[model samples]
Target: MPASSTDAYITDFAEFVQASPSSYHAAAEVARRLEAAGFARLDERDEWPAGGRHVVVRDGAVIAWAAPEGAGPATPYRIVGAHTDSPSFKLKPRATSSSEGLLQAGVEVYGGPLLNSWLDRELELAGRIVTDDGGEHLVRTGPMLRIPQLAIHLDREVNKGLTLDKQRHLQPIWGAGGDGEILGELAASAGVPAEHVVGHDVLVADTQAPARFGLDGALFASGRMDNLSSVYAGLMALLGAPNDAEHISVLAAFDHEELGSESRSGASGPFLDDVLVRIGAGLGAGDVERRRAFAASWVVSSDAGHAVHPNYPDRHDPANRPVLGGGPLLKLNANQRYASDAAGAGFWAAVCRQAGVPSQPFVSNNSIPCGTTIGPLTATRLGIRTVDVGVPLLSMHSARELAHVDDLAALGAAMAAFLTPEV
Candidate 1:
C-alpha cells in the first residue's frame, strides 16, 4: 500500500518536528524507524556485516543500507546524506538566571536563526537530560517556557525591523512567581531531583506543529526546515527502498552541520569514515580496499536550497530561481561551495530520469556570497562524487519555516527512486 502525497507529507513533517528537538532525538527516531522496517541493527563495537541492514553510530548519526543479501566485492555504496541539527536556542551550561525578579533560562543561539522572528512566540524545551546512572537518558517534550513580547508602547519602533541584542532580551520567561530553580522543576517532571541530573543539551523550539496553508493548499510551514526536511525525506526514501543487494544505499544523517561541522558527530569527523570502513569490511574488503571502494562511490548531499523570493526576486539569479512545487533543485556555487560538478550533476540527472523524477537548477545571485553545506566537506573527505539538492524553502532558519507541501512528496519520491532504480 502506498501513502498518499498529502498523507505522506503531513505525517512526515509532523514526525520530523516531533522527533527532532535535537540531534540526539533525530538519530534515535531514525534508528527506531529503521528497526520497525525490518532492518537489522549492527553493533558499532562488532565487525560490519556482509549484507544490507541498518547501523547506528554515536547516537547522533545513522546509516541504513539496502543491498542484495549477498553481492560481489567492490560494489561501491550509494549514499544520501543530510544533517539533523538546525538553528534554534540551546541552553547554556548554567541554564538559569534571574533579572529584576523574573526567572529566565540562559540560551545561546544555534546556527543562523532569524533573531527577530523568535520574539513573542511560545518557546518549548526538548532534549536529552543525562543522569548519574550513565544510561538514564530523559527527554523532555512539551511547551515548557514562553517569551512574552514587549508592549507596543514600550518598543514603538519594532515594526520597522529593529535589531535585537541576543544576550539582553532573548531569554524566555517562565513561572512568574515560582521558586528560582527551573532545573529543579524540570527534574521533578523527569522524576529526578535537580542534583541527580548531571548535564543536558536542551533546545528551545516552536511548539506549533507543521500545517497546510494557502487557498490551493500549496504552502507548508514548519520548524527546522533548513535540514530536517532533508533528514525526513532521506529516511522515508531509505525505508521505502527495495531490500535488494545490488548497490547498497545508505543515508548518513549527521549532527552539528550548522556550526561549521566541527563536532564529534559532524561531517568533518570520523563517523562517516568509520561507517564506510565497516560496510566495506562487511563485504569482505580490507581497509585499503574500503578506501578505494569509497572513492568510487557517490553521495547526494541532501539539504535545503534557497528559492527566489517573490518580493525580492532581484536577490536570485534570473535564470535559476527555483519556484515552489517545482520539484527538487540542484544547488551550484562556483567557488566549490556546493560540492556539485559535471560528473555529480550528470549522475543525479541520470538517476532522476531513470526514476521519472523532475529536477531543476539553482544558482545564487552573482553579487551575493552563497551559503554552504556538508556537501563539499563529504566530497573532499571521502573522494566520492557528490551533488547538492533540496526542496525550495522560505524563511530557512526562522522559528517557523515554509515550503511547498507537494515539494516534500516529490523530493521523497525522487530520493526513493534514486535509492532503488530498476536494474
Candidate 2:
C-alpha cells in the first residue's frame, strides 16, 4: 500500500466516528453505504428484493448482504458480526433533576465505563426521541448538549479515587445554573413541543470527532472505539465482498452488547436467528434444513481488544502484549470470556496470512478476569463457528480512546479478504 492509503484510513476513521453518534446511527450508516452499492433493504415490514439484489434486515438492528447475480446455494456464507452500542450514560424515564439550583439529567451508567475519565469532560446528548403525533414517530436531534463537570474547589478529596454512585453521582448538569424545564428546551431543538415528548433513549457522547495524534500523528482519538472499529471494518468488508460464495455473506450489528447480551437487539436474543429466517423465507428457501444450514454457518465476532498500556506495561501477559499497528488480534481466554477456540483462531490466522497482514494473540493475566463479548453467545445460539478478533486500543472505556491509524485499514483489509475468500 502507498503512503496515501494510510492517510485515507485516518480520514475515513474521522468520518466514520462522526457519522456514528449512536448505535442506531452506526447501523444506519452501514445500511446507507451498502444501499448505495446496489444492496436492497429488507425488514419485517417490507418484502425482500429479487435475486441480483442484496438483502438487508432493519430490525432496529441492521444485517446486510450481497450475493452474486446468480450465486448458488451452499456457498458457505462468510459473516462479519459486530455491535453498534458502546458503554455510556443512558437517560432515565424521569430524567430531569436538580441540585443546588443547577439543572441536570439523571443518568444510569449503561456499562462498565471508566467513571473517572468522564468526571470533567464536555459531554453531549444524542439519540432517538419518540413523539406521539397521530401515532408514534421517530425524531433524531443531532445537536450537542453540553454536560459540564464540577470544579476541584467543590470537593477537597481531589486526588483520592471516589466511588461513583451510579444513581446519585452520575447525572449530568446541563444548564447555565438553574433548575427549569430542560425537556422543553430539548423539545424546541427537535421541533416538538416539550410536553409531547413521550419517551427517549438518550446517551452522552463526546462532541470531538476522531483526530490524528502523536508528534508524528500516528495515533487517533475517537469515541465508541470499543466496538465501532469492528462495525466500520465489517461494513467495509461486506461492501467490498466478491460475487462468488458457497453461502451468503451476512453482516449483523447488534445494539446492546455493552449490557449483558439479553436484550432483543443483543447477541443472546432472537435478532440474528429471526433475520436469518426472514432472509431464507424471502429467498423462497424457508425450510427447516436450510435454516439449520444457515445456523451452521460461521461468524467473525468483531470487537476491540485492550492493548498493553505503554505507561503500565506490567498489566498485560508478559508473552502476549499486543502493540499498536501490529495487526488484528485473536483474543483468547481459558475462562471463555472471549469465544476463540483453536479452530476459530486458526481460521482467522489463515485470513491474516492470505492478506499479508501480521497478527497477534492476547490473553489476560491469570490474576485478572477478562471481559466477555458477543462471540461466545452468538456461537452457542446459532452453533456457528465464531472467532473473536479486534484492533488493539488504549483507554478501553474512557471518554476518549486511542488506536493506531493504520490498524483500522489493517483490520478492514483482513476482513475484506475473509468475507470474499475464494472457495
Candidate 3:
C-alpha cells in the first residue's frame, strides 16, 4: 500500500513541533494555519461575527471554530481542547551568571520535567520578547547553548541514584558573557534595538530534530510531544471535518497547562468560557440559551498519556496497560483526575468505531497516583460533558519523547470523527 494517513500525519506533526518551540510560537503557528484555511481573525475586544469560520487569540492561547451557516443559538459545539506549553526551563529576569569562566543563563524549572534527560544535550533559546515600544517578537537562537554533565570520574557515585539541584546544576552555558551579550544576540535576531527590549519570556528547548526511529520506523521521537502532539491532532481533525456539519466545530489550544493552568490563557481561566459566551451572544443567545448550549455541548481534552514501559512493566496497571501503537487511549480515574465517565467514554468509543479506529483504555495502577489533565477542569467550569483521551507516549516530560506513528494517525481520525456531527 502507498503511504498511509499515519505516515502523512507524522510528517506534518514533526514539522509543527519543530516550528513551535514555546507556547507563544505554538499559538501563532495555529493561527497561521487557521488563517490559511479561510478562518478570519476576531479580536476579543471587537464584536464577534455571526457565522462562518473565525478564530480568537489571547497571549498564548488560540480558539478557532466554524459555525454552521444556519445554526441557531442553542446549537451545541463539538470542541477539542489541548495545551500548548510543555515542561522546560524559563529564563529568569536577571538571567546572567558565571562560574569558573563559563557563562550561564539563570533559569527556573517550569512544571515537572525529567531533569536528568536535559543534561548534556544541545539546547536552544526560543520565546517571545516584548519591546519598549510594545512590539512583540518571537525569537529563536538555534543550538546556542548546552548543559554539559559533569564527568563520571569527578562524581564516582554516578552509577547510583542521581540528584540535581534546580538552581545549581540546571543552568545552561550560553558562552562567555553577561546579560548584555545575550540581549545583543536576541536583539539582532529579533531585528530590534537592544535599548527597545524592555521585557522577554524566553525558554530553553532541546535542539535535536524530530525523526522516525525503531525497526520499520514504527516509532517517532522528538521534543514537546507531551501536548503538542495532541494540539496538532486536534488541528488536523478540525480542519478535516466536513464544513456543513450540524454542530459548531471548535479547536481550543490553551497555555500554561503544564504549570497548573492558572493563567488567563489556561483552561482553568476565563478564556474558553469568555469565548463561548461571546459566541452565544453573537448568535442572539440569552443566558438560558447559553446555558442550554453548554449543557448540550461536549469537550474532549487531549493530552499525552503514558505508555507501559518495557523495562518498568510493574509500574503499569495490569489490566489497563496502554502501549504505543495499540491505539488512542481513553484516560480514566475514579478520583476525578480525568473527567471521563461511563457515558463520555462510550461516546468516544463509538466515535472511534465509526471512524474505523482502534482505541484502548488507561487507568493508573492502584498503587500509583495519576496525573491530572484539563478534562476535569473543563467539565467543571463549563458544565459540559467531557472526556480525556490521548495517544500513548514514552518519556513524556523528557527533553525528547516517543510515540508510535500509527497511533498518531488513529488519534487524528478519532478526533475528526468526534468533530463530525453525523458521527
Predicted model with the maximum lDDT: 3
Backbone clash tally (model 1): 4
lDDT at 104, model 1:
87
lDDT of each: 0.79, 0.76, 0.89
Show model 1 residue runs off by greater than 4 Å. 1-3
- TM-score (C-alpha, index-matched) for candidate 1: 0.94
| Candidate 3 Cα misplacement greater than 4 A, ranges | 177-180
Model 1 scores worst on lDDT over the 10 consecutive residues at 1-10
lDDT of 1 by residue, 171-254 (tens): 888656656676676576678777988888778888877788896767888888778888888888888776564577889999
Ranking by lDDT: 3, 1, 2
Candidate 2, superposed: residue stretches over 4 Å from native: 50-60, 133-150, 154-156, 177-180, 284-292
lDDT (10s digit) by residue, model 2, range 98-206: 6777788877787888887776666666666667764232334444344444566886786585666777667777765655665565566677887888877667777
Prediction 3 global C-alpha lDDT: 0.89
TM-score of each: 0.94, 0.92, 0.98
Candidate 3 C-alpha error for residue 97, in Å: 1.9
